[model samples]
Target: MSTGAFSDTGLFVCFEGGEGGGKSTQSRLLQQWLEADGHEVVLTFEPGDTEVGKRIRQIVLSPETGELSNRTEVLLYAADKAEHVDTVVLPALRAGRVVITDRYVDSALAYQGAGRTEAVAEVEAVNRWATRDLRPHLTVVLDLAPQAGLGRFEERDRIEGESLEFHQRVREAFLAMAAADPDHYLVVDARGSIEEIHAVIRARVAAMLVTA
Candidate 1:
C-alpha cells in the first residue's frame, strides 16, 4: 500500500505538467466550478503562494540568477512547501475546505529530480519530509509534448529556458508517475478545448465528493 497521507475532511487536488500546460486555467476552472457546486475552495500554488515562497520563487525562476546547485534548489522548494502546508494547506483542509493547488510535490519531483538529473528517491524523501508526507487526493497531469508546450511561452524563465531534452525528460517523468498511480491521477491531453478539459476534470472530481 502507498504510504503517503491524505485528508479525511477535505479534498486535495493538484495540477501538474510541463511549461505552458494551462495548470492555472484548469485549476481556476475547477475552483470556480467546485464553488458553484457549493464547495469552500482554496486555490493556491507551490513555491510562491506563501510570503517566504515568493522569495524562493524568484531565486529559482529568475533567469538572472543563472545556475544554482541542484541540491540547493531542492532545499529551497522544500522550505516553501513546509511553510505552505503548515500555514495554508493543512489549516484549510482541516476545516473541510477543498484545496486546489496549481502545483505541488510532484512538480519538484519532475523538475528538480528528473530534469536536473538528481536522484528521484532523494528528492522525494526531502519533499515528503517537508510536506509531512501529505499527498493530494487527485493529481491532474496536463499532458503535452515538451516542444509544443515550450513554444507557447514567449518569455522563458530559468527553468523554461532549459534545453529541449531536459523538458522531454520532465514530460516523461510526469507521464510515468501518472501511469504508476492510475487511481490517483488523471492525464488530460492539454491540446483539447478548454471547456472539454474542464468538464472531464469536473466529472472525475464530482464523483469523489462524498457529501456534495
Candidate 2:
C-alpha cells in the first residue's frame, strides 16, 4: 500500500478507465483546480510520459505493430511504468507536488487481464514490481458502459479495436478493483455531464487535500 519514499510526501492521484472514458479531460480539470488552489501539480500520463515511454506507447498502440503476444504487451506496459515512476512520478511527489496521471497500473491490470486474457494477479504482480509498489492515494474511475464509451471515439487504437466483449470485461475488471478498495477509489458515472463529473471530482479531491 505504501511506496517507501512517497509514503509521506505529496499526494498521488490517478484517473483510470477504458478508452474514451474522459480520463484526460478529468485529469486536466483536476490539475487545473489543484494548481489554482495553490498546490504544485504535475500532470502526466502513462505509456508516453518520457522518451522511452513514447517509443513503448507507439509499439503498444500502433496498429501497424500488429499482433503482439499478451506477454509482450504487458511487459512493454510495465517497462513504461518502471521508467515513468522513477523519472516523472517519484521526482514530482518528492518535491511535494500533487501528481495527477491519466492512467496507471490499474490500466494494465484491467486491460491485459480482461482484453488480452492474461491473469489479473500476474499482471498486477508485474506492475507492482515495475512501479516499486507505488499506488495512487486516490484513483478516480470514470465509469461508463463500454458501448457508450467507445462510441465517443472516432478512431480506435489497437487496444480500442478490441471486441465489445473484451471492453465489457475490462469495465467489469475496473469496477471490481474499485469495489475491493472503496477508500482509495472514486467511481464516477461517465454518463453525467462534464461539469457534473468535474464537480464531484473536485469535491472529493478537496476533501483529500484537507486531510493531507
Candidate 3:
C-alpha cells in the first residue's frame, strides 16, 4: 500500500507505446488501482478530452487527413498540448491530484519527432514552450516489436490508421527516448498477457507511490 507522499504538487504519469502496446488498458488499470487505494486520480490523454483536443484528435487519427507535413502535425499536436496542460493537467497537479496522462510530449518527440525526422533540438524547443517543461514524475514505455504491435492493431482493424512503416518509426523513437532518460522512464515488455503486464505496471507504480 502506497502511503501517498508524492509531492505537495501533483504527480504526473504518462504511458507511451506504439499502437496495440496496451497503453490505454494499463493506464486505466493503474488509475483504478490507485483510486482503490484512496488516492485522488485524474486520467487523461494527449489530444485530450477537451474541445480543441477532440478536434485535433480527429485530424491526427484520420487517415484521410493525408500525408500531413511533419512540422505541421507537430505544431498541431503542440497546440493541443498547450491547451491540455493549462486547462487540465496543471490544475489537477495544483490541487494535488495524481494526473495520469495517456500520452505526453514524449509521444510528440517519438512520433512526430522521429517519424517527421524533426530535429530533436527543434522538437525540444517547441515542447518546452508548449509544456513549460512540466515533466512527468514517471513515464511508462511499453516495449514491443513494431511488426508485432502493428499486426495486433491491424488484426483489430484499428491501426490508429497509421501505416506499418509509420508505426515502425514511432517504435524506434520511443526506444530512443527511453535510452536517453532511463531513471524516470520504465520500458516494460508488452508481449505478456494483459494481466501479467499490468502486474508489472502495478508493482512499479505502487513502489513509486510508497516511496513518493
Backbone atom clashes (below 3 Å) for every candidate: 0, 0, 1
* Model 1 per-residue lDDT tens digits across residues 8-118: 888899999999889999999999998998989999998799999999999999999988999999999999999999999999999999999998999989999999999
State in Å the error of residue 193, model 1: 0.6
Cα lDDT tens digits for candidate 2, 25-131:
99999888888889999999988999999999999999899899899999999999999999999999989989999999999999988777888889988989999
Let me know the TM-score candidate 2 reaches against the reference structure. Answer: 0.96
Q: Give Cα-based local distance difference scores for all models.
A: 0.93, 0.90, 0.81
* Best candidate according to lDDT: 1
Q: Candidate 3 at residue 102, lDDT?
A: 91
Worst 10 residues of 3 by lDDT: 1-10
Q: lDDT by residue for model 3 over 137-164, one digit each (tens)?
A: 8889998887777666433322356666
lDDT of 1 at 194: 95
* TM-score (all chains, Cα) for each model: 0.97, 0.96, 0.90
List candidate 3 stretches off by more than 4 Å. 1-8, 154-163
